[model samples]
Target chain A: MSTYDPNVAPKVSNKPIIWSLFAAGGTVTALLTPVLVLLFALAVPLGILPAEMFSYARMESLLASPLIRLVVFGILFLSLWHTAHRMRITVHDFGLRSDGAAVFVFYGLAAIATIVLAVALI
Target chain B: MSTKTSILPVVGSHHRTLEVEVLRYDPDKDDKPYYQTYQVPCEEEWVILDVINYIKDNLDRTLSYRWSCHMAVCGSCGMMVNGEPTLTCASFVRDMPAKIRVEPLENFPVARDLIVDMDSFVEKLSSVKPYIIAADERTVEDGTFTQLPAQLADYMSYTHCINCLLCYAACPQVNLNEGFVGPAALALAHRYNLDSRDKGRSVREDVVASNAGIWECSFVGACSEVCPKHVDPAAAIQQIKIAATGDYFINFLMPWKKSKNTDEASSGGGK
Candidate 1:
């Protein structure tokens, strides 16, 4: 065997992926909350819809709609992608090698989370 | 054949050797710095400091250097090994081939040999008020404060700094601007400020407000890269900037009320 070793390469981890997922989720939630609140206020002033109708029931119903479902899926996919990228960085920062097993595991988890979220929304 | 007994040669008989050139400076005798060379035997496990020690012990007893703890701790043996800021004790000589160069830590006045004056580093450390301050001072009868694990995790990594000046040596900003507090000191300051039990925001006002504070860091990130402890001085400075920006807004809105209240309290006490 040659003296040169391939095992010395760095590895990535899952923590950064998890952190990025949470950060993206929080940011979207923050932005959407204010915009949704403002839209509800405007709807009441415009008299196109009743203010009280914008409740939990309306939100659940909206999620069941195809258009809303598509938006939700887009957000979830973006958040998961951001998370996976971040996790790779976090793993590398801790001096872990980016071995095939680590990459497989991280990508697998991100894929699973995204699929699960999409199914639930559907 | 019967007259001579068979003997085996040493396994490392053909091992490589290197010529190491080290910069020498003496304030008392030498008008300027000069280079000295030594031929050292190379082994995979040998670090630069090991070669220096060998040269000092066997070649020349008069040659001076500084070292402690041999490991990466104590931060006493930081020097430029082959133009890189490195802990001499931990830098392996075998990594370099044929030639090696060594010099004292940069961004400081060289006192003699490989030692640099550390007065500037100490002064910067003191400038940041690197300690916790409670909003209310408690008497001796009061018990010690407590903190949660999550709170401790915020600043725990920064506390690992062994005061190695490697970050300062690597930081070009510190080199250009002597007034800047540098990386290690700022990281330590962040350590205290981030403590959940510490209510010392008021004390850090002047430090963060000063031009020498976190503003001097241009996010070159060389400090974090050269840091042996992985303290991430760049991250600490960024977090401080976030807090300072928030504080600026709060001060602008409600400055007069607090100032007037303090003035009234002091005047009443004087009466």
Candidate 2:
């Protein structure tokens, strides 16, 4: 007798959705994180680019464009989601018994941060 | 055989004494595992398994382990060497320090000294149906099946799995989820799925798509690093995930067009 029944469908996994998000987040983070760090930590502090580039008035002017706001929001949201997903996996790798509570805690922070980012952008 | 002509203790051969710590346990005699040390005189070019053989042959008759085909072909020599999954036969004594620690492969129940129970691994392997399941059966009238070089290349690397269980020891997902079909089994399934002769991908979807299957893997890539044969099981698992994702959408968008187990040949066009 066959153990699997096609009709019953051994409970299809919803992992594809989460995995796609995680993958997209990873791609975005890997591409942009180092450049962002260099710009803020080294380039700005070293005065390689004028400090006025990141001045409050200049940043506000940049944020005025919906296109720039959307790009920045996408990077922040994806990076946070990537970190949350990676942290969950890392905790499990450390041999800690992860429960539903752990998932809630990790992803809840990302969700809250995303909502806050959205409000600020608006 | 003349003792003088034998390879054993050839004159003027260099030997260095190594202190080897081996993990030991007897189910009936001890409640917990313990390490036992033996000073072994090792040849300059001997591998770890050779050192273990020296211990068994000269130092202690009671020491237990499994090994065959002193080369890396047989996966039976897999054990923890210096807290890393390795085939003892591939670890040269010259590359190691004076002291060596050997233990059973981690995340598996130790059956005895250096040997872990493999029943669960065998079950997982079988669950994936590691053999080729052709859509149509060929009779005696049909001669030998031929395949293109490209088709052979499609799955040649995955065929190198010697069932060493090193990947299982290295995999964090395998350590966490008992039901997760470990790296080797999943890679083997992928290997068969890639084969032009096989037709059991739909049948295998049940286990590979389940929560206990590919979903459990978090893409740690540890399995590929520890594999002696460079099977790259992590890559195979990811490929399975991509295929499974495609299957999910295909099933959702066009349920009527979903191919049945027997109708697999009609769908596989490239073969």
Candidate 3:
């Protein structure tokens, strides 16, 4: 019969929206890396900063700090999610011909990355 | 003596068969739309439009649809094929299973069976001033005007639009808002404004300022996906948004300058 029913709603996918979030996260992460580098370049070199700033101890200590921890966690989480989203789209765009397997692999990687990052940070 | 050559049955007569269900509506007769199915013999290479044409020519002469340039260039045969906005000429019948559903383009008011009222699209096309407005109209007579290839590339892809309106069908924003100028027209506007020889910045002022223009597009990318011509109207609209934003500021700073340039150019025999 007629496929042109008014009630037939168009299907909307979450992939593009998720990818957009990933792009935004990637942009922020990119900006944050430079800002972090600049902050260290300007602030740490001065005698006013802690001498441990150059050592692994400083890195661990910064990771333990609440503000730095929060920022790092957010960046790691968003970037991993973004990577997963983009990887899925890349698979689709390349015509992998296995939607189920592609989804499984992408989400699996994302979940594993999220868990690893979260556990390490927390 | 003449030798009679016997012709064998047509090639691919037994490969596959498709049940095509087409939307039928006669404005002069039927107030409500309905569907009629026809069993069509098709080869692997036969497209959905071919089946429809066969049904029209054989099964029912009363049945109506639209198509031209079966190779897909004319863009006159866009419709919903199996719930997707597709160019009928390009959609192969073999791609579907046992059944195929064909209907008029979505998000447009159906005037009849497979025909939709295109007045709104035409009006929007006109609103964009889809034409070149040369900076020096008289310079053309003197053969002083020419555009570089790179400059032409800026809007070259946008000009390839065949007025398919598939972008409009795929755009949810257009479906939600009837007032929206949709993607095709905005893309056309972008094409003209990007022309190096064109000086129609003012012509597009209202369109860009309107709620229906580029502001309505949410960049769903569906429009580009369904476009058979690879027009990428969504990208054109996005680039136009950037241009509009820049023009908003530039015009504020030099309100008199643009008008003065236009006036001087016109007075100097350039339209």
Candidate 4:
């Protein structure tokens, strides 16, 4: 058991890990999100690509590679973490008090989504 | 018969009446603060401070506020003009609407009419040791510390802070957290830290790297926008954050190669 000492320096916040993830996710989204949106939403529906090319079997086969699975997980997990952190800060900026409930709701959702997506990919 | 036409003066070229609303309070007399309006006959080019002086000199001698060196260099005339923090000496009457609301700077306790208590601000500014700290003692017999043009340019932008404290009024985080070191003080700390001649980074780190220091700032960016001297205190705070983050990780990874003052800073006392 440790007693409280007023003289000790305040514990440094461990925000760098979440901040780094947010930065990486932001970079990934900036470079890849628009292209992904164009391909799946615009190109597929506008007859620019044959529908058979994006069939279920073909998509499953494309994602079956170990390298592709790793990339998918990286993008999905990092983006969720980024959005969670962003929403938490945004809520605080909008004059809402940040508390344990808000933290649990936002970061907890990101944690759960990461676990579920990891299992599905496996 | 030719009739002589009567000449009339132009409408707005002469003086105009400005409805100036000032928040007035006296700790000795009033139970709470209240707004007092004065109809000021203002010239087109007159600034808000001139109008306040007019009220003090003529209408009500009891009106109180701080101002000197009617120019913006003094930095004593900061107030809330029309819901925005501004230097009364720099805010022109011509640019404002006919009716203007003037109040004490936000996030500070009002001492009088428009004068806010600045003891906390002074304390914070001093805590960072906002001055040059050399590793070794220097003598006048030694030549003056000379700096190259490029080196001087590195921290020149942050040296423009006049301490008007408009950034403090604009920062929401400061309003929320009373102990947050605020903008001008942190920026001045960063300014000294960036100086080529100053080796006081280790000494100043105790305050700037403290939890109540740069780490508390959430990058509102309003401080930079409202800065009359274009000091960009927000940018200074961000740069300090990067440095602090690097220091945090470096200290964690290489504990044996730690810098001096690490033990002192760990004691949670300001030098």
Top lDDT hit: 2
lDDT of 4: 0.82
lDDT string for model 2 (B34-136, tens) is: 9999988877778999999988998888888999999999899999999999999998988988898999999899999888999889877887788878777
The residue ranges of model 1 lying beyond 4 angstroms of the native Cα positions read A1-122, B1-15, B257-271
Task: Supply the TM-score of chain A against the true chain A for every candidate structure.
Answer: 0.53, 0.84, 0.67, 0.84
True contacts kept of 1: 0.00
Better of 2 and 4 by DockQ: 2
Which of the two candidates, 1 or 2, achieves a greater TM-score against the reference?
2
Write down the TM-score for model 3.
0.66
Cα displacement (angstroms), candidate 3, residue B124, comes to 0.4
TM-score of each: 0.62, 0.84, 0.66, 0.83
DockQ, each predicted model: 0.02, 0.25, 0.04, 0.23
Model 4 chain B is weakest, by summed lDDT over 10 consecutive residues, at B262-271
TM-score of chain B of 4: 0.90
lDDT of each: 0.70, 0.83, 0.73, 0.82
Residue by residue across B23-133, what tens digits does model 1's lDDT show? 898989999999988887765567788788878888878777778899988889898887788888877765776898888988888998888899878877877778876
Off by over 4 Å in 2: A1-10, A51-70, A116-122, B1-12, B135-146, B257-269
Considering the two chains of model 2, state its CAPRI-style docking category.
acceptable
Writing each residue's lDDT as its tens digit, candidate 3 over B1-271 gives 6364645535566657788888999878887899988898887677888888888888888876778899878989999988899998898766788988888999998988888888888988887788877665565459766666777777789888888889888887777667777888888887877777777755665664354577656677999999998999988877666555555545557877545322222112322
Preferred candidate (DockQ higher): 1 or 4? 4
